[model samples]
Target: MKRIKLALIPYSAYALIFIVAPILLILLYSFQDSSGSFTLENYARFFDLSDPVYLKVLWRSIKLAVISTVICLILGYPMAYILSRLPARIRGTVSFLFILPMWMNFLLRTYSWMSLLERTGLINSLIGWFNGILPSALQLPTLDIMYTQWAVVLGNVYNFLPFMILPIYTVLIKIDKSLIEAAQDLGASRGRVFRKVIFPLSLSGVVSGISMTFMPAVTTFVISRLLGGGQNALIGDMIENQFKVVGDWGFGSAMSVILMVLILLTMNVIQRYESENSGGSVLM
Candidate 1:
């Protein structure tokens, strides 16, 4: 009990000084006006859908996050499944390779895409070589994938793929081989086995992956800024602008609160669905 108390004391102090204090400050500021009078005007501004700019930015952020999450799942699931099936000796090395890029600064990784996607970028140069094989009119347009929604999605997927893979791989590794064999013995096809057994059993991992990828993707400013340009700016950019450009701490805090609430609501809905579906499963 004494050791536990001592351990918790440091954590409690850290939480108070870092998490709790900053959140409390934000909350306090969120309710105050420019004149320092307490008010809900900041939050009220968020619900004014008549301001198409805010609504559009919020929608774009949610859409981008959702699309990126889906892309991560589609790409990561198969990769994770293959990785899970590999020999234990190679799994660690493979996992390391997947995560090695994450050790680099995120800004550097994002910036690297610029060189690969520019008009005279590596991709465009390669395409130009191919275009020489055809008439100028018949040649395909030079790859201009930079500063588009695709760039933002690709950036998100590259950064968050590891988050999706790790969780799904962890869950897949623990899945019972005997259960899979039993399903096969019962005349289940490969698709059926995957859809009914493997997928259902992996809901916890899916939840973890989705939460990890989606939450960060929505709030990420650097990737969209560096890749999507200001044109594809998300709600994160809006909140950033409010604080940095408009010098409106109240509105920024309110935006932060709204984002927090939206994340909470999304997670709750997903958790409830996962719980319902895994109701009778022993795995969870």
Candidate 2:
């Protein structure tokens, strides 16, 4: 017990310096004005019903994050299922393929996406080439969706799909084969088995995946900046601008606190829902 306590000291100190300290500073700065006096004006500006620009940004962030997370779940769930069902011999290879891109620098990955999504980028250039051979009526329209909300969504889905996939896949692969076999023996159809047994058991993974994907999607400034062309500013972008460009640490910290609170609330709701659902399903 003494050794364990001593061992934890290093990690506890690391957490204090890196995590607790930063949160404390942000909390402190959040209530202070530029003059270093305490005030509620920062939060008031965020919740101002009259202006509501910041509120709109917050809404947009949630909206985009929801869309991205839903898309990931829709796409990832099936991919994870398939990966889990794959033959054990080749599963590692295929999973590696999914994980390969993540090994690259995140900035490089986003930049690569930017290149691909650009007006005259590789995708459009290929389309133009294909159009050159086709009749005028058969030519494809030039792609022009760059620097839009859709672009941001695309970036989010591309980057975060793996996060959704890996967690669900981990859970799916760990599901007991006997349960599936018993369901099969009990005359449950494939779809019914998946719906009744597989999905219920995998709820924890889905919850984790949703939390992981949604948090980053909501708070991402780089994807919005690179793909949104600064037109569709998210709460993240606003917070970044407040601190970096506007030199308003107080407002930035306030926004950060609000965003943090909103995230914590969302995660708590999800966790509570997961507990209730998982318990009920297991009981049934």
Candidate 3:
């Protein structure tokens, strides 16, 4: 027992230095002004809409993150289900292939998307070729969605989708085969079996995936900076500017606190939802 407690000492010290210390400093700085005097003015700037930009950027971040999370859920669940049903011998190989892109650099993957979606890039070039082969009116127009909010959302969806998929796949593969067989034997149709038995069983995975994907999507600055162009940016961009450009640490710390609270509240709500729906079909 003494040996095990001693073994944990290094990790405990590391956490105190790296994790707890920074959070404490941020909390302290958030309540202080330039003169290092305590005040709630920085927090007031967040709530009172002293700067309209704060609320606007925050709402936009939440909206885009929600849309990206929903899209990832829609796209990932089907692929996870298909992967879960593959032959046992080949399932690991195929699942590894599904996650191959993630092994590459994240920035490189996003840059590849930039190349594919630019106005004069591959997509538009292919559209132009199709237009040349067809009549005038039949010509498809170029996609000009690059450097827009759509682009940011697309980048987020691409980057975080695997996070959504892998968790659900893990859960699905662990479901008891006998439960599924028993449901079928009891005269449940294939669709009914899925709706009642499989779907309910997988709710935990879906909730976990949503939490994992949405949190990063909401806090992403790189995707917004690269894909959203200069005029369009998220709350993360605002926070970054406050620290790096404006050099206002107090406001930045306050924004950080607000963002942290928002995420914690959302996670609590999701936990409540998971607790309520456990072992039961939401559809029923």
Candidate 4:
């Protein structure tokens, strides 16, 4: 145990320098105004509601993030199951296919989708093609969702679905075969087995995937900026603008601090739920 503690010293130092120091700096800067004197005004601006723009942006961020996380869950859970059931020979290949996109730059991956979704883009062209092939009443109209909330959600789901898949896949593959066999021997249908056994076992992974997906989805400025145009600016965009464009570091830091607290609170809720469920699972 002492040797293990000694091995952790380097990582502890690294976190202290890189993580703790930066957070302390952000906290210090968040409480200060233009004159560098400490005041509550920086935080007050966010919650003041007299001008509710920031509050609305934060809410929009949450809404879009929730949508993205839900979509990923719907898609990823099935994908993870399919991947987990694949034969070992092909499973690795399929998993690699999922991971291959990550090798590209994140911005580049997001920007690629713009071409597919934009006006005069492939989707619109495909719709136009369908229109040509069908009667007027049956024609598909051109999609105009570019630079909109839908586009933002699409962008988020595309980028973060893998985060959802990987964790659930990790947990699903680790499930004991005997437990599943025993459930089957008891005459549980596929749905019942999943509901009572597999799902309960995989709750930890689902919670982890939700956390991973929602955090990046909420805090992402790049996808929103590239796909949402300037109209659908999220809280992240607001923070970036404050620091980079508006030169209001104090307010930006305040927003960052708020984002951190919100994420931590969300994580805490998820962990608490996991703990309660885990205890009940053991009891069962």
Candidate 5:
């Protein structure tokens, strides 16, 4: 027991100095004004009904994050299912291929997408070339989603899709084959088996994937900056601007605190739902 307590000291101290200290500083700065006096004005500025720009930005962040999460879930769930059903001989190779891009730098990946989405980028250039072979009326319009909300959404989906796929695949691959066989023996159709047995059992992974995907999507400033071009700034952009450009530490910290709280509340709701639904399927 004494040795165990001693072993935890370094880890506990690390957490305190790094995680807990930064959070406490952010919390402290959140409630202070320029003169270092305590004030609610920073939070009030965020929640101001008359000038709801910050609120609008926050809503946009949540909206885009939710859209990204849904798209990831829709696309990832099927991909994960395929991976889970793959033959064991080549499954690792296939999964490695799927996850290969993640080994690259995230910023570099986003920058590559930027090149593709640019007005005169590869996508548009391809459209231009394809148009040369057709009559004017038959020519397709060049892709123009760069610096738009759609661009940001695309970036989110591309970057975070793997996060969604890996978790659900982990769960799906671990599902007991006997339960699935039992469901089939009981005369369940393929779709019915998935609906009744597979999905319910994989809810934990789905919830985890949602949390992982949504949190990063909502908090990301890089994608929005590169793809959104600052016109469609999300809450992340706003928070970043408050600190980096506006030099308003108090407001920035307040936004950070609010964003953290909102994420915690959202996660809590998801966890509560997970808890309620867990084991409800009973392998049926």
Candidate 6:
């Protein structure tokens, strides 16, 4: 008991100083009025459903996060399965190659896509070259993909793909080879084996990966600002605007609190669904 308490003391202190303290400060600020009196006005502003703008922005953020999470899952699962099937000696190197982009500066990666997608950019330039061999009408239309919701989604998927891949890969690598072989020997189809055996075993990883990818994708302001343009604002952008441009720190803090609560609710619902389906057994 003493040893566990001693170990917890450091973590508790760190949490107090960093997480708890900051959250408390936000809560305090969230309840304060412009005149510095305690008030619920900040939160009440969000409850005004008549204002469609807030709901629109919030819904857009949710949609973007959901789409990105879904794409990451679809893409990551197969990649993870392929990597897990590789020989042990080459797995680490391949995994490193997969994750190497995530270690690069996020801002740099976001900006790089701007160069690739901009008008007269790499993609358009290639299209222009290909158009030389065809009638102008048959040429691909020049796209203004930048400053759009698609750009934001693209950036998000790129940024969070590694988060999704790593968790799923970790779970896949630990799957019992004998179980797969037994399923095959029992005359189960490959698809049936994957659906009945592999996917169920990887549910925990899916939950973790979806949570990691979705939470950050929704709360992210930088990618939206850089790629989606300032006009194509998300809830994160609205919170940032309140804090920085509007000078409404109290309202900003309230928005932050709301965002945190939404994320928690989403994760909890996902976990509950996963648990029910998996019969409450954790893969690990």
Clashes of each: 0, 0, 0, 0, 0, 0
Question: How many steric clashes does model 1 contain?
Answer: 0
lDDT of 6 by residue, 74-185 (tens): 9988998899889999999999998888778889999999999998799999888888888877987777789999999999999999899999999999989899999999
- Per-residue C-alpha lDDT of model 1 across residues 1-284, encoded as one tens digit per residue: 78777888888999999999998898899999999999999877887867767778899999999999999999999999999999999999998999899999999988998999999998899888989898877888887889999999999998999999999999999999999999999999999999989988998898889999999999998899999987999989988899889999999998998888899999899889778777868655
lDDT of 4 by residue, 1-284 (tens): 78888998899999999999999999999999899998999899999878998999999999999999999999999999999999989988999999999999999989989889989998899999889989988977789999999999999999999999999999999999899999999999999999999999999999999999999999999999999999999999999999889999999999999999999999999999989998999998
| Clash pairs detected, candidate 3 | none
Give the TM-score comparing model 5 with the true structure, all chains together: 0.95
CA error at residue 2 for candidate 1, angstroms = 4.7
lDDT of each: 0.91, 0.94, 0.92, 0.95, 0.94, 0.90
Error of 4 at 279 (Å): 1.8
Supply candidate 1's per-residue lDDT for 66: 94
Per-residue lDDT over 1-284 for candidate 5, one digit per residue giving the tens place of the 0 to 100 score:
78888998899999999999999999999999999999999999999999999999999999999999999999999999999999988888988987899999998999999788788899999999999988988989879999899999999999999999999999999999999999999999999999988999999999999999999999999999988896999998898898899999999999999999999999999999888888565533
Tens digit of per-residue lDDT, candidate 3, span 1-284 = 78878988899999999999999999999999998999999988877765676788899999999999999999999999999999999999998987898889988888888888999989999998998899987878789999999999899999999999999999999999999999999999999999989988998999999999999999999888888888668889988999999999999999999999999999999989998887345355
lDDT of 5 at 139: 85
Worst 10 residues of 1 by lDDT: 275-284
lDDT of 5 at 251: 97
lDDT of 6 at 22: 94
Weakest lDDT window of 10 consecutive positions for candidate 5: 275-284
What is residue 265's positional error in candidate 3, in angstroms? 1.1
Q: Superposing all C-alpha atoms, what RMSD in Å does each candidate have to the true structure? A: 2.2, 1.7, 2.0, 2.0, 1.7, 2.5
Model 2 over residues 1-284: C-alpha lDDT tens digits? 78778988899999999999999999999999999999999999999999999999999999999999999999999999999999999988999999999999887888788788789898999999999999998999888788999999999999999999999999999999999999999999999999988998998999999999999999999999988897999999999999889999999999999999999999999999999988898678
List candidate 5 stretches off by more than 4 Å.
134-138
Which parts of model 3 have CA positions greater than 4 angstroms off? 279-284
Residue range with the least summed lDDT across 10 consecutive positions in model 3: 275-284
The residue pairs in collision within model 5 are none
Q: Residue 264 lDDT in model 5? A: 95
Higher-TM-score candidate of 1 and 2: 2
